[model samples]
Target: MNAILLILIMIAMGAIIGGATNSLAIKMLFRPYQAVYIKNWRVPFTPGLIPKRRKDMAEQMGRMVVDHLLTPEGMQEKFNERGFQKQVIQILQREAKGWMHSKRSVADLLKQYAGVTDARGKMTAYSEEWIDKKLQMFIYHNQEKSIDEMLPPEWKISAESYFDSFAARIADKGARYFESDAGRVQLETLLEKFLQGKGSVFNFLSSMFGNDKILDKLQPELVRFFRDPSSAMFFKGFIIKEWEKLLDQPVWKAGAQLNTKSVARYSVKALNRELTVLDRLDMPIAEWAPSYEEHIINKWIPELWDQVQPALSAKLLSVFDYLELEDVIRERVDTFSVGRLEAMVLAISGKEFKMITYLGALLGGFIGAFQGLFALFFS
Candidate 1:
């Protein structure tokens, strides 16, 4: 009876020690959330394994996530998948369909999306500003350049070719003006003035010949002079000289007379009138572009996806590099409280951990049993 009681006592003690040690070991994995210090010395294993190695664990986690889970190849593969593409397309189509039936005007849409209150006014202002800026830039760039240098070679050639015709037209017009009754009257007055300017003898001759006869002769002579080729050549030379003077002047000199603000405003107005689409800004988009949905679904979405998916896949590596995803994961893990980390780990592998604890207990019990048997054998 004493031997049997001894054996029973040994077995019970072994089981209790085994179970308690195992439970304590399991608890030690996460107990005492912070390090414990006694006077000048620090207690060993006070903050637990996880808390002590949190930084290294976080780093490892980050590297593991980046290297294995969120690899560029894996992302590219997912992006290229037909399922992802189809989902994106379907989402875009649904949004487009909603927009197509919307009663909101373009201006309203602009207001909602871009915070633009007056779309037309804003566009006009922007256009005017753009025009003004461009004009200013042009003036700044060409202010020192002479018109001759600024003019295109082809334009210079064309202008030179037309000079003769221009001069001929001017001469023809001058002759016709002189042939009119008004021209005759002006000729008579000029002759009288000339006689008066001369001495009384010339005046008496002019009166004796009669002003009418003098004018008739003067008019024919004037017409003949204008018809003469030399007259046309003279006008052409005059025109060429004037043109050369103009061409020699710088662009700033030419533009000095212009009102740029007024020009920009007028240009904007003309553009607004010519672009009839601007008028549709106040009208509902559905009214103007009813086929938008069909086009978006059939053409735009597919084309956009086709272009964007490959680009995204190609850029996935660059994006991942820029994001430093591993560092992000590591930082997140580091920030997590020990208790929270423990809870999460337990949640994932709680059953396995329990089994490990039980295994440890079983092993401990086996060891205790062997020790007990050895003591008995020695006795």
Candidate 2:
């Protein structure tokens, strides 16, 4: 009876000590939520391991994310993937299609993108100051190229050629007018006035010939001369030369009242008029969808992406650094409450941590048993 009682007491002590040790260890991981103090002395292991190392952990995580997961090469590889590009293009098409189909006006879309809304929840027109700033940026970018140089050769030729033909047409019309009856009447009146001004010799000759007869005869010959094809051709060539001279005039010096800003403003006004027309905006995307897809895929997309790839590769790292990604991440983590941090960690590793606690209990139980066994043996 005594032996049995002693063994049972040993087993009970072992179980109790083992359970207590494991529970205490588990509590230590999160106890003291903050540092504890005894007067001027800080109690040993007051703050939990995680709380003490939180800042360092945040920094390490930021570095690991940026250096490994979000590296430039990794991002570039993802961007260059064919499937990714196609998916992105499809998403953009869907978004644009949605915008076109929606009842929203262009003003609404602009306001949404610009993040400009009034108290009434209505979108206002862009301020002149805002438009001017945008225009100035555009002007600065294109400042190195003259207007003619900026234009594609084909476009320049097409516009200039229209004026070249217009000059010839104007000249043709003027030559024809000179051969008309009204022109003959004016010429006859001028001739009569000239002869009247000349002294008596011309007047006497004109009177003998009869002024009406001389005038009638001279008028037909003058009209015939102007009606001649060669005369029309000569005038056409002269007008075309003058028009060419006008074309060569510098754009800025072409008119006393005009400057680049005024021109750009006028262009903006014209574009805004077209843009605001609800009729134009109401058209379905499907009407031009095929053409849009074709041009975008074959021409615009390739050309734009070619430029984008180089520019992105060169500046993406600098832009990421400018964004202060590491600081942003670290700050965000630091802002999280300890409770939240604990919850997050537990959420991720709760099972493992629970197993660790159970294992600690088992180990402590074996240690206690061993001690109990030694004590009993010595007794």
Candidate 3:
């Protein structure tokens, strides 16, 4: 019995040592790769499991990321997790505030506004007169025929939607110009003088032309602006301001209900009259169409693009609201990068290996003790 007991103890000790040695050896296989390759000596496969098939390992890792991590379903699952929206909003808010509070933002905004005012003031040096002259020239110098000949044989719904969209776009673009600080100041000053009946931009021009008859001639076109608001946005704004004063109303909503309806009816009447005159007299607007796009493109479009561009650009000054910060931290966090373990866990049967690694010594020791008991019983 003593001899048997001694043999059993020796077996258990040998088994424990062997289990420890094997576990350590397995760990060493992945610890590092590529020992120093100096002179004529080598570590003889000392460099680990990854170095043996590094290129293949890389391709496999990329494949795993694409298949398991970067898929639409996986991404959606992550996005659907709790507190995601709050995290995103917080990040966006922080970024906005950071940008808004930055000194760079102040300098950039100042430069941008300065450039705008400088360019606009220079162009408008005598803009009112120049625009008036150009519009008049367009009205004049036509052949003795109705412009109806240029009309298409049929109207199109698709074409109408396109035209309306283009018109709306033009309206939006023109909206940006007058929304500026300098623009508002100039427009307000001009209207104030006009409404008080103390200022006449026409008077200045009339004096220069040596006749007030030109003012009388332009009465038709000037009245035409109120009738067709889109064509005369600058004047339409003036009309609105004057009406607001007359009504003594703080809000447009507080004014008469018929205001919008009246404006619409007047606009329609004005457009119809203008079209009739255009159809009677030879003018391009009588046949504005997709087919005519090429002709206008080659002729008037490029020639007047610079002057007309202002009518198409709208100014928007964005100011973001506060209370957003968690998003900033989360977006900056949740980025896990574990290198070899990351690659290994994604590979075949390696996830099980990872679980085993945490408790391998304990598990391996238990297995070795069972092996020792079996050896003693058999001996």
Candidate models: Cα lDDT each? 0.86, 0.66, 0.46
Superposition error at 227 for model 1 (Å): 32
The deviation in Å at residue 117 for candidate 3 is: 17
Candidate 3, superposed: residue stretches over 4 Å from native: 4-8, 35-45, 76-83, 101-105, 108-379
For model 1, residues 138-216, the per-residue Cα lDDT tens digits are 8789999998998999999999999999999988988998999988888877877778869888878887998888787
- Clash pairs, candidate 3, are 87-327, 173-312, 173-313, 174-311, 176-314, 176-315
TM-score of model 2 vs. true structure: 0.63
Error of 3 at 294 (Å): 46
lDDT of 2 by residue, 1-379 (tens): 7655665566666666666776666566666579999899999987877677789888988888888888877777877787877776666556655554565644455557876544112311333345656656655676554455555789867765676456556555655665677776777778878897799899899889987788678766765765566665676677667656655654444433335456555665676477643333334444434545656655665566656766776777788878887888888887777778888878898888777766666666576666666777898
Off by over 4 Å in 1: 1-16, 98-117, 127-290, 371-379
Residue 317, model 3: Cα distance from true site in angstroms: 33
Best by lDDT: 1
Q: After superposition, how far is residue 209 of candidate 1 from its true place, in Å?
A: 32
Off by over 4 Å in 2: 1-20, 37-42, 112-172, 175-223, 240-303, 368-379
Model 3: per-residue lDDT, tens digit, 1-379?
8756665565566555655665565656554556546577866665666555555555555556545655445545545545754465456555544443344433234347664333323333334445445434433432222233222435333333354445445455445544455545555565445545445765565457633244344433444443454754554455555543533432222322334444444554465566542232222222333344445544544445434333322211111012222333233222322244436545865656655553555555556567666766798
Candidate ranking under lDDT, highest first, comes to: 1, 2, 3
Q: Could you tell me how far off, in angstroms, the CA of residue 247 lies in candidate 1 after the best superposition?
A: 19
Model 1 earns a TM-score of 0.57
